[model samples]
Target: MAHPATDDARLPRSGSALDVAEYFAPQRTSSEDLPEIEPLVKNLTIGVLEVLAGVREVDQLARWLGEDAYRALVTRSNLSARARSARGVAAVRPAHRILTQRLCEPTDGVVEAVVVVAGPARTRAVAMRFEGWDGRWRANSLALL
Candidate 1:
């Protein structure tokens, strides 16, 4: 009998296993081999989710947060910092259906991302930016996103 494709095997082919490997392979951002964006994107996503669900306190964030994200959220929750920034809120939250465009590395150290926020007759690009900080690509700004 032949083996079935596992979950990760379903990724879009990069034309060959070598390309596929290079595409998904972990590269060192800060000496460790974690894919730079995954964890940070996840933390940012969770913070957004919690805020949308009316959990605004920074302490509500999980401690396992990738550090850069932890600090970003902390700054966001601080009255002095949050009040100074003119940021917009997403009209539809995650439970409503959120889509993420695959992140692309357009330059040497920066990653560009497009998160689509969807609602009835509405779709908006939540433009996100990330920088490699201590081995992870943490959200630089939701306001910019």
Candidate 2:
């Protein structure tokens, strides 16, 4: 009798084993293969600020963010909404200007940047890390200071 493993008809006949983990894993794209990242960074910075300010929904920016970053933004957005509720402050679109942006590339496909924004109330800095994945830029980490 044939062994159960060898008798399986579902296995590939090509003789080359398939690596399920690697096949399903997120693909990392090189910087050379990606589009200009500056525009994406700037847009994402503004989008994130809007989300946290409750002027925009986190889902609007979900496609540009990784799993962890998306979850964190959702949590932060919820907290902001709760705080607004507590203070009885209606959600208003924040009027702000992007003051400056500083970026650094520690790796070929990864960029770390900080954007300084000026608002009517105060100036704040948003730090973010973007990685090239599957031919697009995705925010993997973000922090507002």
Candidate 3:
């Protein structure tokens, strides 16, 4: 009995175009080199989260935001008629353990999220935002939904 050659010639060349390298070329993609999922949320959340991971003071939270919104977000705890909402939640003197999430529109790179702040409450749903810098994906505004 003979075994199949199992080489490039044995396989369909067009389908195997990405076979140039063993590790990197696994598939031949027609789409752009980007993820299928929307990046609307994940990108911002990830950046803020990464910065927060290194944070030792309240001021650091303001740094993740755009210039105009920073002042509003840092002024004090005030979001709605709801008393002392997650407003300045990160600035609470002591941080809370809670879930943080980013809902995505990957292609647009905009997102919404529920950021876990303090005890019991656990999360805040941030929604309806855009992500872009010169038409490229960036978290333009992060809001609590």
Candidate 4:
């Protein structure tokens, strides 16, 4: 008799046992991997700000955020229409910054962060939460400040 946990038939066709070991290894928490994840963070933050500012619409936010985040953004917009319009960013500067916190459960995933975008007159902080869905990081919720 064989145990289901050790089912050989369900294993990958390629890669040795050591390969599997390396695949699940703990990820590095240095800025070395930051560049790879930068676009997702920056794009989503800018898009959210644009939507709040009325320069962009709600539907446009779907590209960077998940359904829940989209709904949350819409609700926030409705709640404070005047503020969003007044504080709308004129232009985002070239050098925005991202801060990240690694997840505890899984090995390699960034679950949350704060993105700072500098405009002509003001700097806005976009608090974002992300989830690994379909092998990519998708925004789950965002708050504009």
Order of quality (lDDT): 2, 4, 1, 3
Can you tell me which runs of candidate 1 are displaced by over 4 Å?
Answer: 1-43, 59-94, 100-102, 119-122
lDDT of 4 by residue, 1-145 (tens): 7787799887667888798887776333433334355567767776676666556677876766778888999987665566645787453223434444232222354467777667655777777776655455667777777
Question: Which residue pairs in model 1 clash with each other?
Answer: 127-145
Ten consecutive residues with minimal summed lDDT in candidate 1? 88-97
RMSD, each candidate, Å? 15.2, 3.1, 13.7, 9.8
Across 1-145, the per-residue lDDT of candidate 2 in tens digits comes to: 8886887775666533456666667899998999988898888988988998899999999999989999999999999999999999998888889999999999999999999999889999999999999889999998889
- Positional deviation of residue 20's Cα in model 4 after best superposition, in angstroms: 26
Segments of candidate 4 deviating more than 4 angstroms: 1-35, 80-107
Runs of candidate 3 exceeding 4 Å displacement: 1-59, 77-92, 118-130, 134-139
Q: Kindly report which residue stretches of model 2 are placed more than 4 angstroms away from their true locations once superposed.
A: 1-12, 15-20
Q: How many residue pairs clash in each candidate?
A: 1, 0, 16, 0
Can you give the lDDT of residue 130 in candidate 1? Answer: 67
Give a tens-digit lDDT track for model 3, residues 69-144: 4444443223221332334333232244435554544553343445443433444444434433332333335554
The sequence of per-residue lDDT tens digits that candidate 1 reaches over residues 1-145 is 4355655665565488788777677553641333656556545555654554345555565333445555765665564334434454433333535666557777665676666655455555555666655455555545423
lDDT per model vs. reference? 0.54, 0.90, 0.40, 0.64
Candidate achieving the largest lDDT: 2
